[model samples]
Target: MKKKIRIYQSINTKIVLVIVLLLVFVLQLIGANFITQIENQLITSFQEDRKVQMDFLESTITSSLEIEESGEGSETSPEQEISSLLTEFSGSGITDLQVVNSELIVMGTSDTTQQSTVGQLSDDVDLRQAQITENSITRQVIDSITQNRRWKIVEPVFSSGEDSQFLGAILMESNIESVYDQISQITWIFLQSSAVAIILSLVLANMLSRALTKPIKEMQLQTREIAEGDYSGTLKVYGEDELGQLASLINDLSDDVAEAQESIDAERRRLDSVLTHMTDGVLATDRRGKIIIINEMAQSMLDIDQETATEKNLLSILDVEDDVTLRSILEKQDDILVNSRQNDIPIILRASFSLIQRESGFISGLVCVLHDVTEQERIEEERKQFVSNVSHELRTPLTSMRSYIEALADGAWQDPDLAPRFLEVTQNETDRMIRMIQDLLQLSRIDSGKSMLNLEIVDLTEMLDHVLNRFDMMIHSAEYEDKKYQINKEILEQSIFVEVDPDRMIQVLDNIMNNAIKYSPDGGTISGKMEKREDTVLISVRDEGMGIPKADINKIFSRFYRVDRARSRAMGGSGLGLAISKEVVEQHGGHIWADSTEGKGTTFYLSLPYFPYEEEEWE
Candidate 1:
């Protein structure tokens, strides 16, 4: 469980408390001293008043004594005169007044309750001390009988001569309770004032602390907003003080941070756009060779998950050797060609390395750009093979023609039979060369997308029949005098019409028939079939001969591809027939494919969009 904090513990509350406590302490100190001084002054004033009264009574008594000695008032006794003077001073604020003689005898006292003490020896210690010293003495005492606090003043009355004799001591006592009452009342007033002062101090301190802390609290809230990624808030300045200056700085900082964040976000968006649309794969790594940034192209090319690849080692993800880390690549500063595979298909990637460096020349990381050159490399290899195959194909017939021409020139023409045969052989070679050249030109046009088709609706059944009839005539010619071959046609009874280039379609059919004748054995039968589906016409040419291997079936339609190179060459096949046929069919918005079994036979299929036939058009 978390502990809860109290409001009094907050800075504002603490400040208020501190200010109040200090004020209270100081006020109490000053009030205590003031009260003490007032009490002392009051007690001193009371003592002075009592001393004046005692001096006056002493003067009066001394005057009376002188007159009595001079016989001016001889009728009155000296004790009676002193007693009447004491009586006069008794009720004049003094609690008690006494006149003692030189023998320590009680001459007179103003207290009526102490009348019996008259004419008795005074045992008062104040009087004894005053007679010995012959000086006035004052003392404060608590009355034992009445338990009242009082002041005692003793004055010695002296004669007016050079060696004055002490007549007696005048002892006076005054009750100090009135002075104490005034002090008590003043203390109460002081206590009440202190209480009021403390309350005012607390209220003033609270207000002052609140005024000081309000701006700080607002700044705190603004800072919190900034921490939460909102840099739009600005602090309000309270005064031209340090805290106000801090608020101004914070406001400026917020604006600066907001601008920096905007710039950073704009840069990030631009970088993302470039990475998203770029054709080449891009990968960035940290100084430690850990993956930091990877684009979609990189993920697709590397066959790795973007989320999973992040923070992983770059070399490990690329499947490169352990020594081929990003650090090593950066150090080498060279492009690397990585030969890798995806889904068992060979892929060649050209990876170019660049250093991500700081202005201080410190190498921070590496940037690797990967370009997939698999198709480019494959095309290059194919061009080389095409050139080689064309050279070999042309050289064969050219070599034969050269040899035969030289033989005829060497007098073989004189032998009539040998000359005609040699001429015949040269003509055949010339024809084969012409056929090869024609096929090459046709394929070149098709590949360049320059082949134009003369499209027309043709009767599919009639077209097949015409091609089959030509092959039937060729089989009975001198080329098939010993080998017996047959053409079997299984076409639709109803004539199907299709939109195609008739010449190109005838060429396509003738090429398929020639291949069938070349590969079929002596007595093998060739089957040709045409059928009309819902919206298309399907044509199939099959032969009972050596079938194509499944591995080479997909490549059979490629230019210069041959399952049996030697057999095809011996049969004067340039290996471009089916490739040309595929192009022609596709140019007519049709498709062509082959299906063959190794030990059974081979079949070629061609599909074209079917054209509807009307009776009026046929008429």
Candidate 2:
């Protein structure tokens, strides 16, 4: 949005104001000097005119005094002649004129009000000063009664002789206020003319200001539009001047800015797309280690929302502050493991760090990429354990076989009793090793998805009966005479048909039955139950034997796991039966689990998905 400019703040208004101010200042200075010179000239001319008039009147009075001395007085006395001369010479400017004789007495006066003092001795200070100095003296004073300005001039007259004698003096009072009034009138006229000139200057200044600011105002508007991301408008160029060139430059700048903005927008969108789709979590932090950028994957890995994650310290988010500091990570630039559990699920992440540095080798921030490695790390650990278990399992039997073979080679074979027993023990150890290897290979195939099931439709009732009958046959035989056991079968009378690989299913049953028989006491009963449910057929083998502990029950199906390692080994068990059964059952789209009472018994159940089908259709 374009901001509104105040009238007082506008460039146009400022230009107008500056011009008017400068004109006023110049006029003030000129007027002061002009008025001063005019006042001085007027005062000087007024004084000079007064002096010339006073000198002429003094000479005429001196002539009157000489006539009286020569005894030529006829129609008028010397004093009357002097007074007449003074009255004749006194013009518009003269207020009063008086003639005093050499005795300091006023002989005659033009002022009627002062006629009484004309015959008396004149005590005027100017007249006394004129008599003493024997020269003309003048002083200006104000009238006490009228408060009017007056110029006083006293001229001493001398007798015409080789030694000039002071005869009398002529005193004149001139009203000089008219000279100041004229000067004031001229000053008023000058002020009127100056005001007219100032008004004209104001109008001219306004026009010039508008002309100077028009282009600038247009440019300002266009620039404001450009700032608002509207680059379509261009400034009008009035002439080939600085303003015109500037307008052209602005148009070019707008184009450049628009292109740069588009490019930046495109790059930003591309970055967002890449960050959204990336598999690994990405995080970026500023130099202070506060998170500035975090992708969705990073948010998920950290179990944080964007609002919570932004500006949070990187170490705090990763929860590795106790182990490492930001400086350590930056200096090492190494990968670290983050182990966190959210919602009771363990999450393991491998975070790799890199520096977000400038070309000048200044490090600005750090970038961390997190790849989830939970499943991979678990597999790696299981692989190592599997290898160690296999090594130990094979080594035990191999060592036993080697021991017996060496005994026979050292002439123990010659002893009839020792030879048979040692050979039998060696043979048993060899068979155990062979069985363990076969089970390992079977598990490997199942895990690799190479063991395809030979599926067939079989009646689950008959399948359970078949497995039970085999165990029953084993129990009845002389080989199991010492360890007597009973097999109890609880099969659904109605034939329950299921889709399965018959051989694998039999193997699974064999594993459960053998475990039950091995753990049960000599007179223990092994109960096998089968039930037809809505969507699955469940088979459980219950053994009257010491049950698995609660803690180890979940791990009973793991490879190479045994509750009693010494007893299992002594019983010629490879410890892979349950693990193999679990894998096969899962491959067949089934689940296997166990339930046990610590001192009473354990039940192993296998459930396979089942759909109700017509028996006739399967036949």
Candidate 3:
């Protein structure tokens, strides 16, 4: 990764560069103005000095000319007298001097190099202009050959009289190199001063930039730390400035964010706890129906691992049809029944959907609550079957009674034997229906927890003997004489006492014995055994006959359930005997179960807790 530049360094660099550039520009502008002013002043002074020198030279030459003209005995010529004065003035900073007459001829010269050209016409423009205009003229020029700057001044010399005729012009040229040299020296000094100022400005700018950007850089670092979830450090307030205020605000913001995060984390933990411990499965999806969150129950219910389920499309995992998307369910606010299977056992889940929406009324995602309703649905189906079975059972006996009564009503009573047989059949069917109804009422009472056992300590051995003897007497009678049913008893010799309602216990024992007799073949042995265990007395009834199938053994104790429904109904069995027996056993703090094998006999086992009989209580 490329390294990041620090904010302070960048800010500092830019600030310093801008300040330095501004300083350099302003300083240079001042320096240029100052130099130009100095050069102009120096040139103006040099021109004035040249004009003064020329005026004095012109006055002296005219004085000499007038004095010589007035003196009859004067020997000096006008040109020689003027040349003597010009020579004196040329030595005083003048580079060249010349005297011109009215005819624009060079009358006298102070330059030795040009002395041979005396009496030559003056080719100087200013001198010719002075002669023509009769006015003094001054101009400055640079010498082409020497490349020296010079100023030229020309003045007309007049006669010393009232008429004052213009005699000639005096022209003088002086070098101004010294003034240029001074101006150059001053410009160099200004440049040096400007360089020093710029250097000082740069140093100060760097320091100032540091001062300005140091706090801002600290704030930047603090903000970055805050972003990474650290709100421990605070920036030092350097001054009561905008940056300082900003730093304070950032610190405040950090505190607020930390507090908000803590609250959010706490809420998240609470939600997680609820999801973890909830019995129902909960699933959350995104707007696109991708799974975002799935709790443990959801994972277990869907038989999916978290790693495989997360971020996968919800519809794909659910294997729902196209029309049953999470969004559609949420929008319709409907509960869906999802049918699935685990371990080949059908599972039914009732899933209620709720929409997750934003504050702006936009749907963001969905939440589904899944409840396992398999057991409930099975119970509902069983209840329906029970009602149907009850109706069928009642309808059969009623139909038989109705047919027999109708036959009697249709004059069967006139045939005495037929009418009597028909009447007997009706009476038997009525009794069977009455028995069936009584059994149904008893079962209803047991289910509603309204049947209470009257507890009494009694010898279980005597109870078993009493039930067996009742069957034995029935077998000995003429009704069962052709089919031999034998009772074999294996009673515990030691008396085992138990606390139970004697009537209910007898009812249970009778039901078991009757069932054994009903399923046993002719001459099959029905065995009864009473064994005392460590904590309870075990009473079991066994039959040697065609045994219950393995698959029907578990459901034999259910109400209206029969191993052979047709045979059971033909034998006047209500199919609730074992069910009632079980309820009675359980109500007495005992349990009953069956052990059966195909092609072998089935043993119905009843366990009752032993009671230590006190003599007084037994009495």
Best by TM-score: 2
The residue-by-residue lDDT of candidate 2 on 1-619, one tens digit each, is 5568899998777877887788788878888888889878877777778788877776777877777656675787887777777678767788888888788878788887888887799878888988998877877789888887888888888987878988788888888788778878978987898789878877888888888788888888888888887878877878888888988888898888889888988999999999999999999999999988899988887788887888589999999989999889989988999996645688999999999999999999999999999999999988998898899899998998999999999999999999999999998888888899899999989888899999998888898998999899999999998877999989889888788999999999999999999999889999999887789989999999999999999999988889989998888888899999999899888999999998799999999999888759665
- Show model 2 residue runs off by greater than 4 Å: 1-4, 57-207, 210-214, 329-332, 340-344, 359-365, 395-425, 472-488, 517-527, 542-554, 562-575, 595-602
List the lowest-lDDT window of 10 residues for candidate 3.
65-74
- N/CA/C clash count, model 3: 0
In order, what lDDT does every prediction score? 0.86, 0.87, 0.85
Q: For residue 161, what is the lDDT in candidate 2?
A: 85
Kindly provide the TM-score of model 2 when superposed on the true structure, using C-alpha atoms: 0.80
> For every model shown, what is its TM-score relative to the native structure?
0.64, 0.80, 0.66
Q: What does the lDDT read for residue 312 in candidate 3?
A: 86
lDDT of 2 at 226: 80
Candidate 3, position 413, lDDT: 91
Rank ordering of all candidates by lDDT, starting from the highest: 2, 1, 3
In model 1, the number of clashes is: 0
**Candidate 1 whole-model C-alpha lDDT, 0 to 1:** 0.86
Model 1 error, position 207 (Å): 11
Q: Best candidate, lDDT-wise?
A: 2
